[model samples]
Target: MYIPQLSNQKAFDSFILIDGVLHFFQFTIGSKHAINRGLVGVGEKYGFPKDMAKWHFTFVMPPNRVLKVPQAHQGPLKDSKLYSAILDVGVEIPVE
Candidate 1:
């Protein structure tokens, strides 16, 4: 899986899967104050609640066959950028 990353970014650097939706957090200078606030749970590791609106992409359930997101703790979709990216990847539907 070739996930896009910024300069020297790791797999789980600036992103988190909250409730099955993968969110990309693009932090800016103005966001410094908000980032300072305490982030609770796994969502904080990626800087949520503040940068929640800056999410880059969102894929609906069944993100693709190659990757499986455990359906455990999920939240509401706040915002999104490109749906085309999700379609271009061709996610596989799981078998029931």
Candidate 2:
């Protein structure tokens, strides 16, 4: 399942559920604050478990761009045990 950005306060760029895990994705040019706040808000709104083991957060940006996580949000993000990933734009697919 996949959902696009919501019009609420806890709006996220994308939401996906694979198997039983909830994955929230944010695509940003350089706003670290938005990424930090959005993820936290979504978890709170959904009443996710404290460990957040089933939750995944992905930060997507253009190729060659680097996103830096804010220091203040580092601990919470890490402690939640959230899975994180990155996807670059304009990658070619191989024919198999």
**Candidate 1, run of 10 with poorest lDDT:** 28-37
Q: Using alpha carbons, what is the TM-score of model 1?
A: 0.25
How far in Å is the alpha carbon of 28 misplaced in model 2? 1.3
Error of 2 at 50 (Å): 5.3
lDDT of 1 by residue, 1-96 (tens): 224456754222255556645564432212111121122344566445544444444223333323332221334333334331223335454444
The Cα error of candidate 2 at residue 91, in Å, is: 12
Each model's lDDT: 0.36, 0.56
Q: Could you tell me which residue pairs clash in candidate 1?
A: 19-74, 64-91, 64-92, 65-91, 65-92
User: Model 2: residues >4 Å from true position, as ranges?
Assistant: 5-11, 31-50, 71-78, 81-96
- Alpha-carbon runs more than 4 Å astray in model 1: 1-41, 58-76, 86-96
> Could you give me the TM-score of model 2 versus the true structure?
0.54
Q: In model 2, what lDDT does residue 32 have? A: 50
